[model samples]
Target: HNRAGKGLGVQLFHSIEALKTYVEGPTFEEPVDGITLIQEYILSPESYITRCEFVGGNFVYAVKVDTSEGFELCPADVCQIGDLF
Candidate 1:
């Protein structure tokens, strides 16, 4: 999951310990590393998330991200392979 030797971005976890384990554990082939983020986990009403972009008064773009698939939310196409971010 190491793309050009950089990690994929933010992930939401149920607990701090789970997040800590993931950060400390060998989820990667190399040593896993990260900052501990403590945030409230909000349960979404839908399985998919909607992202919208606007240009002044005009709505430019929107997309639905299915959380049922998984969390790999990179905006770049190059970085979005395999995980379908």
Candidate 2:
């Protein structure tokens, strides 16, 4: 929470109205002002995501995020298990 802001708060939505409400509703302060990201949600088995880190063309480490708790992917108290293409 302290390192990467509030992380991804309340990412999953069941309906369009819910998503709209969250988009328009109040939220915690972002680490950067006016910086928010929205994306198409996809369903996946186990609700987990894998992240790979690379440094200087070398693989460093990998993390498999568990989204059952929430979308915050950080190692701190809070995280987001997002997919990028």
Candidate 3:
């Protein structure tokens, strides 16, 4: 998922240049004080993240966000979603 266009949505980067392009657009120049980080990355077979919240010790709300198309999941009333979208 760290391909050319997936960086902006998920922070996934194929290389330093790709990350820079996402930050500064197509024509990107290296910054003098830019920060770089290396961390453990795990690949998940499931292409989605489920967020759940509870209230009063009871089940409240849950949502499943698809990761195949992109990473940022917009809340209801502001975006469109579905298996066919």
Pick by TM-score: which candidate is best? 2
User: What tens digits encode model 3's per-residue C-alpha lDDT throughout 1-85?
Assistant: 2332223324567787766667678644343345333444567799876777688999999987776666555545546646654
Which is superior by lDDT, 1 or 2? 2
Write model 1 residue lDDT over 3-63, tens digit each, in one string: 4322345467778788778868876234244333345757887887677777798999887
Query: For candidate 2, lDDT tens digit of each residue in 1-85?
Result: 2334234453667888987786677864453456556568787877778877788999999877666766666654323234541
What ordering of candidates by lDDT runs from best to worst?
A: 2, 1, 3
- The C-alpha stretches of model 2 lying farther than 4 A from their native spots are 1-6, 26-31, 55-58, 76-85
User: Which candidate's lDDT is highest?
Assistant: 2
**Model 3, stretches more than 4 Å misplaced?**
1-10, 15-41, 53-60, 75-77, 81-85
Native-structure RMSD, model 1: 6.5
User: What's model 3's lDDT at 14?
Assistant: 76
Q: Whole-model lDDT, candidate 3?
A: 0.58
lDDT of each: 0.60, 0.62, 0.58
User: Cα RMSDs of all predictions?
Assistant: 6.5, 7.8, 8.2
Error of 2 at 68 (Å): 2.5
